[model samples]
Target chain A: MEFILQNLNAQTGSFLAILGAAFGFFLAAMGSSKGVGLAGEAAAGVVSEDPGKFVPCMVLQAMPSTQAIYGFIITIMILGKINANLSLEHGFILLFAALPIGFVGFLSAIYQGRVAAAGINMVAKRPEEMVKGIILASMVEVFAIFALLISILLINNVG
Target chain B: MSKKNETNFLYAVAKIKAIENRLLDKSKIERMLDAYTPEDALKVITEADYGYSVSEVSDAHIYEVLLEEEMQKTIKLLSDISPQKEIFDIFMQKNDYHNVKVLLKAEFLGIEKDENLVETGAIELRKMKMSVKERSFIDFPPILRQAINDSLDTFGRTNDPQSIDLILDQACYKQMLESAKSLNNDFVTGLVKALIDTVNIKMFMRLRALKKNWDFAQRVLLKGGSIDTDVYINNLESPVDSVIELLRYTSYGNVCESGIEDFKNTGSVAALEKLCDNYIMGYVKKAKYLSMGMAPLIAYYVAKETEIKNVRIVMTGKINKLPNEQIKERLRDLYV
Candidate 1:
C-alpha cells in the first residue's frame, strides 16, 4: 500500500487528469452499453414477430445511449484541461468532479435501460402507443442529464 | 434465482407480449358464439390464424386435431424460450399424468390405445406408451414411475379401473405441488393449491349429491391443498348448504355459493366447473401487466390454453346444435 501511494504521488498531474477523464468516459460508456443491450434484447423480440417494427424498436433501444455521449463530452473537456504544469490539487479536483457523471451515469443508464426495455413491449402490442412509451422512458433521462450538467460545470470550475 | 437468470427473461417476456396480441378476445369469442353454423365458426377461427387447413376439411375430428396442434405449438414455443423449463413443465405434467392413467387403464382392460390420449404431456405420449407396453419404468421420471407403479399395483389388486384414476389423480397433484414448490414461485404454488382446492370442492359436492359414503369421498380426496383435509372430511355428512357455508371462509367461497345456486337451478355442475376455471384465469390475468420475469410468459400460456378451451367449447356446441345462450353459458372467460 505504501509503495502504491508513493508511485501515485510520483505520477504527473497530467496522468491523474487522464485517469479522471478515463473514469468519466469508461463508466458512462459501460452504463450505456448495459442499458442499450437491455433495450436491444427487447427490441429483438419485437422485431422477430414483426420486422416492420424495426424502426420504432431501434428508436427505443437508442434512448439509453445519450449518457455515453455525455460521458464522452466530459472526458474531452477534462482532456482539454490537462497540462504539463497542471497541479496535483487541480487534477484531484477534476477527478472528484468526474464522480457525479461516473456514478450517476452508471446507475441512471441501467435503470433507463430497464424503462426502455419495458417500452419495447408497448411497441410490440400497440404500435400507436410507441410515442407514449418513449416519453415515459425518457423520464429516466432527467437524472443522467443532471449528472452530466453537474460534471460539466464542475470540470469547467476546476483550477 | 441468480441475477443473470432473472435478466434472461427480457427477450422471452417481450416475445410473449407480441404473442399476447394474437390471443382471442371476449368479443371474438362472442362472434364465434353468434355464428350461424359450425362452418361459420370455423371461418372466425381461421381468421384468427388457428386451424387454417383443418377448417377446410370441416370435420369434427379435425377440430380436436387443431386444438391439439395449437396446444403443442404453445408448449413448444414456451419450452424453447423459457429460462426455467421445469416451471413451464408444471402445466405439461398434468397431461403426462393423464396419459399415464389412460395407458394403465388400457393395459388393464386389454384394449388398444385410446385416441383421446393427448400428446401435450411433458413426457411424449408415444414414449409413455412404449414404457407401459414394455413394463419398464427406467425411462420415466421418478415421480411418474412411482405413480405408474402405485396405480398399477392398486389396479392389479382390485381390478377396478376407477382405482386407477384415483391413484393417478392423487399422484398427479402431489407431483404438481412438488414441482411448484421446487420452482419456489409463489404464483405457481398458489395456482397448484387453488387447483387442488377446486378438485376437492368439486368432489365433495359431487359425492354429497350422489349420497356417497364417507369412505368413498375420503378415498378420492387429495391432500396438500390449501383447504385443510379435515375441513372437507368434517363436512362429509353435512348438507350441501352447510358445506358451501364452510367454504365461504375460503378463497373459493363465493364461487362455491354461486355454483351451488346454479346447480340447484339447472341440475348441472357445468356452472361450477366454469366458475372454477374462470377463477384460475382471473388469478393468472394479473400477470398481464408485468413487463419482466416469468409471470407474463406463464400468463400468456394460460391465456392460450383458455382460448383453445373456449374454441373447443364453441365448436362442440355448434356441432351439437345447442342454443346460443346455452353455449354462451358454458364458455369460460377470455384472458384478453
Candidate 2:
C-alpha cells in the first residue's frame, strides 16, 4: 500500500496521516453514537415509567461517549504530527497508530452501550442499585482506556 | 435468526421490567385473601392500577368487568410499545378461536350467547361473530378458516357439541405452532408446545377417567406438543398409578405427579388445572434474568394473566365464604 501510494504521488506522507486522523475520528464517533443510541433507548424506557429516575438513567446512557473522546484526542495528535517533510514510512506509522483506538473504540463503545442499557434496566427495578449498575457498566470502559493508551504511545513513537 | 429478533424488544422489555413492580406479590395476595368483604378484596386489585379506573365501574360484583378491562389494557399497551405489533397475536388468537367456538355452538343450538364471549381478541369480536355467522372468512387467517369448515363438517356427521370443541382445540394449537414458527423464535415455539402438552396431558387424564376409547382419545389429544400420541395411546388402559410412574421421568413428571395425586384425593380436576398453570409459570420464570429479548415481554403477559387469575380466585373464594386454605390452594404462583 505504501508503495502504491508513493508511486501514485511522490509526496503522500501527510495525506496518509490525515487519513489516519479521519479514521480515528469517524470510526470511534460512529461506535459512540451507536452505543449511545442503544443505551438512550433503554434509558427512555425506564424514565417513562418513573420520571424521578431521569438522572440515574442519563448517567448510564452517557457512559459510552468516552470512546468518542478518545478518538478525538488521537485525531488531534495525528494532525499535530503532520509536517511538510513527513516521510511515507512515518505516515504509515501514524495511520497504523490510529487503528488501535479507531477499531477498538468503535467496538468497545457499542458493547459498553449494551452494558449501560442493561444497567439502566437494573436501575429501573431497584433505584437504590443505580451505583452498582454504573459500576458494572464502567467495567467495559477499561478496554477503551487501554486502546486510548496504545494509540497515544504509537502517536508519540511516530517521530 | 432469533438472535436478531432478540434485540428488537429492548424498549418494551425494559419498560415491562418497570411495570412488573406493580404486579401482586405474596403479601398482596394474602391481603386480598383476608379481606373482610368481596368488595374489599376487589379493592386490592383496583388499587394496583388494574383495568379501567375505579370511578368507571360502580359495582364490585362485576369483577369480570375489571378483569376484562385489565386484559384489554395490557394487550393494547404491549402492542403499542412492541416493534412488531403481531408479536402478541399468539395469545390473542386463542380468544378469537374461543369466540368462534361460542358463536358456532350458538348457531348450532339456535341461540345467542353473547355473555359467554370474551371481549378481547386479535380480530374484532363483532367481525368474528359476523364472519362465523355468514360462513364468510375471506379476511380471516387460512388456518382458522379451514378449521371452522372442518368443525362444521365434523359436527354435521357426529351431531355432537364435543366434536366442535375437539376440532377447534386442535386447530388452536396448530395455528399457535404455525404462528410461532413464522416468527422463527424457539422461545415462542417452545411456549406454544408446552401449552399444547399441558392441554394434551390434562385431556388424556380426563379421558382415562371416563374410560374413553382409543379413537376418542386420539381425536381429543391435540398435535404439535413435544409428546407424541403414542405416549397417551399406549397408556390408555393402564391404571392411573402406572401411568404417572411411566411419566415420572418426563419434564412434566412433577406436574402429572402433583396433579394426579390431587385428582386421586379430591376426584376433581381443579388442582390439575392449577398445577398445569404453575408449570407454565415456572417455564416462563426463566425470562426474569433476560434483560433484552421477547422473553421478558412474553413473561410479563403470562405474569399479568396469572395475576388476574389469582385475583379472580381470591375474589371468588372470599365472595363464596370459602376457607383461606382453599383459596391458597387455588392460587397460582406470583410473578414477582
Candidate 3:
C-alpha cells in the first residue's frame, strides 16, 4: 500500500483532479449558460413588451444559476483532493461522483432557463402578479438543486 | 439513432430559440397595461400577431388564443424532431391530464360541451371532448388514453374532484418519471422531476389549506419524486415549521424564505402562492442557463401558463373594477 501510494505520489495526480473540476465546471457551466441565455433572451423580450415587469422578470430569469453552483461545489471538492494528501483511487471516486451533478446540472439548467424565460414573458404581460410567474418557474429548480446537492454531499462525505 | 436523428436534440433547441423570438416582450406588456380599456388591450394583442384572428376580441377570446398559441408552439417544437419517444409520451401525458381535468370540470359544472376544449393535440379537441363526455376512459382513442387509465385509477375511492385531479397528476408524473428513468437521460429526468416537485408543492399547499388528514395527503402526494417524501409528509403535518425547515436547509431555501412567511400568515395564501411562483421562476432560470434541453422548454411552458393566469387575473380585476394597486399585489412575479 505504501509502495503504491509512493508511486502514485510520484506521478502528476493533479492533472486528473484539475481535469475533473474543469470538466464538471465546464459541463455544468455550459448547461447554465444555455439556460440563462434563454432566460435572458426571454426577459429581454418581456422587457421590450412591458418595461414595468423588469424586476419580476429579471428575478425569475435568474433561476438557472443552481447548475453552476453545483459545478462550483464539485470543482471545490476536486481542488481539495488535488491539494491534499489522497490516494489516486480515492481521487477517481471523487471525480466520478461529481459527474452526475455536472451533467445533470447542465441539462436541468437549460430547460429550467427556458421555463424561466417563458415565465418572465408572462410577467411582462401581467406585471401585477410577477411573483406568481416566478414561483411557477422556480418550481423546476428543486430537482436541479437536489441532483447537485446529492453530488456535492456524496463527493464531500464518501470519497 | 441515425446521424440525422442524433442532431434532433440540437434541431429542437434551435427551433425553440426561433419560437422564443416570436414572443411579446416587457414593453409590449407595459403598452397593453397602459391601454384605456380591455378592448384597447385586445387590439394590441391582436396587432402583435399572437397567432389569433377574431372578428371582435373579448377577454375570453384573447385567453383562448393565447393558450392555443402556446399549445400550438409547444406541439410544433415537439414535432420538428421526435425526441426520445418516451419523453414525448411523457409530455403528451401531461396534456392528457389537462384535457381530462378540463373535461371533468366542464362536465361537473354543466358547461357547454363545445365551448371549453383547447385545440392543440394530435387528436381533435371536439372529438376528444365528446368521447370524454361519454364517461368512457377505456373506449377513448388509444393516443388520448394511453397513460390516462393509470392516472384515473390513482383516484380509486376519492370522490373529491380536486383529489381526482391530484391523483391523475401524481400518476402522470410517476409514469413520466419511470419512462424518463428508462432512457437514462439526465436532462429529461431532471426536467420531469422538477415538474413533479412543482406539482407536489401545489398539491401540498392545497392539502395544507384544506387541512386534510395526513393519510389523505399522503395518498395524494407523489412518491419517489425529487422531493423527500418524508420531509414533505412532515411538512404537511406542520406546514409552517416543516416547510420552513425544508426551505432553510434545501437549495430553495433563500428563494422560499418569503413563501415560508406567507404560510405562517395562513391568511396570506395568495402571497404564499406568489412566493412559490417566484421561487419556481428563480429555480428554472438557473436550470435553463446550465443545460440546453427540456429545462428551457419546460420553463417556457410554465412562464406561458403563468402569463395566461396573470392576464386572466388582470382582466377579471378590470372587469370587477378592482384598484390597480390591489391588482398589482395579486399578480404573480413575472420571470423576464
| Candidate closest to the true structure, highest lDDT | 2
Tell me the TM-score of model 2. 0.96
Q: After superposition, how far is residue B253 of candidate 3 from its true place, in Å?
A: 1.8
TM-score of each: 0.93, 0.96, 0.57
Q: How much does each candidate deviate from the true structure in C-alpha RMSD? A: 2.8, 2.2, 15.2
lDDT of 3 by residue, A54-105 (tens): 6876787688977898788778877876654555665666667678777888
How good is the docking of model 2, as DockQ? 0.70
The full ranking of all candidates by lDDT, starting with the best, is 2, 1, 3
For candidate 1, write residues A15-72 as lDDT tens digits.
Answer: 8888889999899999999999999988988888888889999999999899899899
* Tens-digit per-residue lDDT, B1-336, candidate 3: 232332234334433443454455666666666666766765655665544445445554355566567567656555554354344655565666677777776665677554545565445666677777675656554534654554445444554466656656666677678766765656557666766665667667778778888887777787766777666777776646667677576655653567657766764467656766766666656534422344455555556666666766666666666767777777766645
Candidate 3 chain A: worst 10 consecutive residues by lDDT?
A9-18
Residue A115 lDDT (model 1): 89
- Tell me the DockQ of each model, to 2 decimals: 0.70, 0.70, 0.03
lDDT (10s digit) by residue, model 2, range A20-131: 9999989999999989988898888888888899999999999999999999999999999998778878888889999999999999998998899888889888999999
lDDT of 1 at B204: 74
Give the better candidate number (1 or 3) by lDDT. 1
